[model samples]
Target chain A: MRDQPTGDQLLATARDLLREDVLPTLSGSQRHNALMIANAMSIAMRQLQSGDEPERRELAALGKILPLPESHGLALQQALTEANRALCRLIREGRADSGQTRDQVRALLLETTRQRVAISNPKYLG
Target chain B: MMEETLRQALAAFIAKETGAAEARISEAKLLTGGAVQENWKVQVDITGGAYAGVLDAVIRTDSASGGVAVSHNRAEEYALLKAAFAAGVTVPEPLWLCADKAVIGRPFFVMLCIAGTAAGHLLVKDARYGGDRVQLAERLGMELARIHSIRPPRPDLAFLEWYEEAPALHSVGRFRRYLDSHAIPHPALEWGLRWLERNAPPRGDIVLSHRDFRTGNYMVDENGLTGILDWEFAGWSDPLEDIGWFCAKCWRFGAKGREAGGIGEREDFYRGYEKISGRRLDRQLVHYWEVMAHAAWAIIAIQQAERHVSGEETSLMLALTGHIAPELEYEILTMTEPV
Candidate 1:
């Protein structure tokens, strides 16, 4: 809404320029560096494209697992941090090892990790 | 030039260490591809003495920064390379170690550099090495078996802690403790760790494990593997740990089709290992350790990313490594979660 080229669009253009236009001219470590920059840009673009959907979904999943107040006046990132810390405690204490809890925890962890992988490296999903 | 000064120092050190009358170093240049260590390629020509030949060698020393927590120091790495060389593991011949800080302002060691490419992507992608992938994979397995031939209870390897329980359990516990200390709370990684802990096989005869034995760590040429490099992470553990680590999907460098280090099939590697060690690889046990491999790599990726994130050593490579964590975590879930 603000401009013609959005954040993700600009990032995608830059990444393509680095990979297709600039990368072929370089070799050895310089090429490797350029490729890494392109990779980082690509991940950033993916995150932007996905928006806050992954974060919101993760929070929803965490709310069911952790004893947290829904609709609390906490930021999504803060809520995630608190929920993950509590989940870690439960896992470490062996409370989430067996029965229905383990299945829920596993499913949530898998879903959350899938979201991360989708942003970071979608090719790895297969 | 700085190169001339380093050359003179290196020649003088070589003369003193080998009791040579005179030694001259030439063509000294830094080699790439060791995030934690610096390797300088040098040609050393010695006059009449016990060491009296022109040699293409590598001067390996610690980098200014970005050393892994689990790796050995330069002196220790020199000893490890020496032990591997003595065991005929196709490693570079360790020549001399200079522990004196006065020599190069840090500890360093020189070894005879061999010919080959150690780039994982190149080896996995190139069609030139396609014909010999099976043989190369088997030879690597045999070489690993030879490395495992060196068992524990040695006075030299006394620094390595022995595990009375299963070494797999020890590895799981160590990684869990590392994660707990960080307190970052990676549920997928935790799930993998829990699986590893529960499925750890009984401790077999503890042998020297090349903890980082994988595709990227070895050198291969048109003919075959020239040298098995990087001995800093070598330690005593279950032999199968190396096998799992070698075949781990994460280390395949995008050549996931060829499971054995992305070079050849697993059966050939296992057959080669069994031929030497007389012990068959347990497929199920190896699978558990493979899960552990992903978890361990994820932890390392996190640590590498921290080096950049914490501003301790700002490196693009380290920063990129952090992006690999989610992928590794995803792989851990696929392997450990009920499917």
Candidate 2:
């Protein structure tokens, strides 16, 4: 429904401007600030490209062991946050100490964490 | 004239401390890029005093937003520096401590300035600085052993709280307490901390640890290390904690091949440490502490990010640091298998 230049495309273009043009003109702390801005913009662009699929996948994974409420009215980010907290509670109660539940909890954590790292810093996954 | 007035007050204070007839401050410049402390480089010329010389000095004090509660205050840090200096550690000479806030709007301490760069990003890649990497690492280890030589039950360092519980558990409790205040939960941190609590080694080899003894915290000239800097995070803990923190993959700054702080082989550093401490280290136990090191860094990264997120401080660097936690969390998970 949106226009041709999407959020991700706009950020990618802006970051290109910063890295290609503005970065060469700066020095010292100003250069460092510009680099950080470019890096942050790149991260935003990557996240936008990935969209909400990762969070949805994480929520479905969390629902495997922990019972999910049918038709729970919440946004994707909020739902993931609440579900993750519940999983943390389960982990602290020693549910993830041994047996199949432990394996399941670790799998979800690893899968979801890898997805997050991929978004934040994909080179880390490599 | 306001700057002149402050300079006069500072010069008068220096004169009294150095027993000089008059101390003339030629230059007083504030250094940048410290969140917790403010360092002012003051050039003082002493006239008719026991310490009569042209001195390049640095005066350190708390920032406008006073230092975080965890670090030592100005006087305590000065005492720590003196203790390290006395113990044969390479450190700047602690000259004088001013407790009277009237002198500089905050209590401060003065020390002789040393020349060197402490930036990890540069030190790791550029061999021109820090000389031979192997000797630099060995020297760092020896310096650490000297710092660990100072034991507890001292009236001077009485400000450091002694803990009956294992240092590992103490850190876990602290991480948990801090996470409780955070808006969102950190499941990976909780899971990793659980592993730490379960596998914590008994409190036996307790020694003073330079909690932030990584590549960036210390300064090194082209020849070798000039001085071990940033004594704020020093505390009593297992000596291996420092070793583990030093060797953690996260501290390596992209040079993951070289283990000893991305500078040299771990064996050389350990050899220097063993020579000084007269004790062998358990290399296996250091693995657990390495995982803990990642967890500790992740916690600190969160703290930095929160400082920016809460509007307490607006810093792009701080915001970026928060993003580093996932990689650390991944490391923690990789190291601590559920089996």
Candidate 3:
């Protein structure tokens, strides 16, 4: 649906320009700022490349434990946020402390957190 | 003219405080790397007084937005520094505190400027500083022991509220309350808090814990540590809390191999601490608090991100700090989960 230079591609190019071309010329705090900008651009590019898969997967995982409505009229992000809130409530209530439920919760948290790390800083995962 | 005015004001204040006939402050320059506070370096020349000598000192004041919710104010921090200094901890000598706002438009304190690099990444990587990592780690442990020697039930630190619950539980409750106030839910962090609450060890002797006693909070010259810095987050808690925080994997930066603040082995640091404290540490509790360390850092990272996200303060560093939450969450999960 988009043009040749896609969102991810655009971000990747911008990051390259700042990290490789412009960063060498800068110094001190300016260099630090440029590096941070480059890091943000990289993260944005990864998020775009990964798309909504991480969110959808997380929601599907959350739906397993909670009685999520089949036809709840909400956008994906909103639904995901609500599902996470429910999960947090379950954790606080100590409902996720048992055998099977604890395992399920742990798995979901690990996968979702890993996905976020993939976008934020994959080096940490490695 | 503004610089001249500040110089004159500072010189006058120093003269009055130190009983110097003449005091001149020169090369008053602001230092970097304190997100919540401003540190200004100044050279003071004193004449005809007991303190008649050239001195390098640091003037610390709140930034425009002040500090975090849990930290001490300037006056309290000055008192804490003096206490720590008296306790024989390797801290900067607290010289004077100016509470009068008219002096610098905000409350500020001055301490003897310590010489060393407090940069975390550089300290971990550059062998120039941490070449003799064993000695450095041991010295750090000894310094921490000195800090832990200062107990509570004192008039000077009466402002610090004595928690009814165990210190670990108290911290978990605090973090949970903060999360409740936020717009979004942190399920990962909630899980961490739940785990921490469920498995918290029994209450130990509540000594003064350097809450932020991590690699980045201290300084290191080539010879070794010059002085411990950033007592803003210091408080009364379990002694193991500081040790756990020192060895936490998150605090190790990228040098994960060297567990003690990415500087040396945990054995050496613990050995130094045990030598001075004369108490054996529960190694299991240290692990639990290491997990808690990540949780606490996650909460702090969230708050830092909120400062940017809420449009209160726009800083790239703060935003980036928030991005670190996922890694912290992953760490919490790894540490809490069974092998």
Question: Which has the greatest DockQ?
Answer: 3
TM-score of each: 0.95, 0.97, 0.97
For candidate 2, the docking band is: high
Cα lDDT of model 2 by residue, B78-156, tens digit: 9899999999999999999998888878888999999999999999999988998888888888999999998887788
Residue A74 displacement (Å), model 2: 2.1
- True contacts recovered per prediction: 0.69, 0.75, 0.92
In angstroms, give how far residue B316 of model 2 lies from its true place: 0.6
Question: Which wins on DockQ, candidate 1 or candidate 2?
Answer: 2
**C-alpha RMSD of candidate 2:** 1.6
List, residue by residue over B116-156, the lDDT tens digit for candidate 1. Answer: 78888888889585348888888988999999999877777
DockQ of 1: 0.74
Summarize candidate 3's per-residue lDDT along B108-151 as a digit string, tens digits: 89899998889899998898984488999998888899899999
Per-model DockQ against the true two-chain complex: 0.74, 0.82, 0.89
- Badly placed stretches (over 4 Å) of model 1 are A1-4, A69-71, B33-35
